[model samples]
Target: SQSSVDNMSCPSTPSTPTSPIPYEIQIATEDDRESILNFLQTFFFRDEPLNSYLGIITEETPRCLDLENFSLKELNNGVNLKAVYNGKIIGVSLNGILERGWLGKDDPYKHGDTKFGIILDLLERVARESDPFKKYPDCEKAMTVKILSVDGTYRGKGIAKALMAKTRELAKEHGCGFMSVDCTSHFTACALKNLGFELHYSLKYVDHKVNGEVVLNPAPPHVAVTVYTQKID
Candidate 1:
């Protein structure tokens, strides 16, 4: 259910006071695309050579995913996919409105639709393959957390926790009682768990072969465990 954004609007919330690092957490806009991409490039590719998949897209892809064109309506309505620090863009968390009967429908990944379709396909497969679905009470909810990331340089500095806090705030602001995330990294899963997020189920998929060897990538499934704390309450 993670939809795209078209245009981004600056957050109405007052910017938090500067700290030693002078970090600022705000809703991301299209203007922040370059920074976000740069952050991702550094964190997932440059710093962590093990995660080259994060930089799979070209320059054009970021524009398509920018908040200026795809999910403009949601952005205006206060659906926040934000960044942290002085435009360093250390983190991102995005969610989308859910449709009724979404779980019963066939996988939305067809042929075209590119980015959106790819994500839908990934989620569909993950859901079908994962087990222990009962723990994830929010699976049937009408919203999905599409992205959550932290820059490598900023990792271990509590930025991830801040990002989760903001994400919870956004969900509550939108009156969404449920949220979900598809985690592919151990760090992400740990962060979610530390924030009290519970595992609904996990899917291991053979996405592709690397270095002529097949690799099993375990995708962690998560759902909102609590309302006020955004933890697994």
Candidate 2:
């Protein structure tokens, strides 16, 4: 009987669960900032060096925590999912726009006709493989799916998929057609692929030694993956 319970899926529709182990998904508010940070800190450091990439520290200051709050606040342009069980925050999902020209325009190094041509070629290749290009606002105009994270305690319970389905639901409601995410973990990538995401491009980085010195360089370029799903049936 206990195994049967594990096989059951949460209610597909959005609402608070009524059972004893109740769970609810709702919009995250400013008051949830501390809980959000605590949840993020759990996963932010699992990969050692990569955690450094996020600029997170074990001794987080109140100001740093506030910055996390600010980032979430700005992402209000998209869907933010918070899963609450027993009146405590247990999981979260943040998805929003990845605007076109946002990347190329921000990097001053890629200016002028030559650099523009190279970057544009890359963008075109990305656009060709991404499903976002064919949907609502067009992939080049805006990105639908972006960030998804689930708490550690709740892993292996299908919570991630539930949150993703909720994201797709929100994207459909917003009149957006496609979604994409840059995933670093193989588990995350494989899960997205299972949900119909495809690989578009991938670039590896290597820290190496050259001529008795050390250097960091981009590894051979590879394909990037894109996960695409039509929010509407």
For lDDT, the strongest prediction is 2
lDDT of every model, 2 decimals: 0.48, 0.49
lDDT of 2 by residue, 34-81 (tens): 677677666543331323333334455323433354335544454677
lDDT of 1 by residue, 119-178 (tens): 345545565444222344564433456556666565556666776777677766665555
Superposed by TM-score, candidate 1 places the C-alpha of residue 126 at a distance from the truth, in angstroms, of 1.8
Weakest ten-residue segment in model 1 by summed lDDT = 1-10
TM for every model, in the order presented, reads: 0.59, 0.59
Compared with the true structure, model 1 gives a TM-score of 0.59
Error of 2 at 159 (Å): 0.6
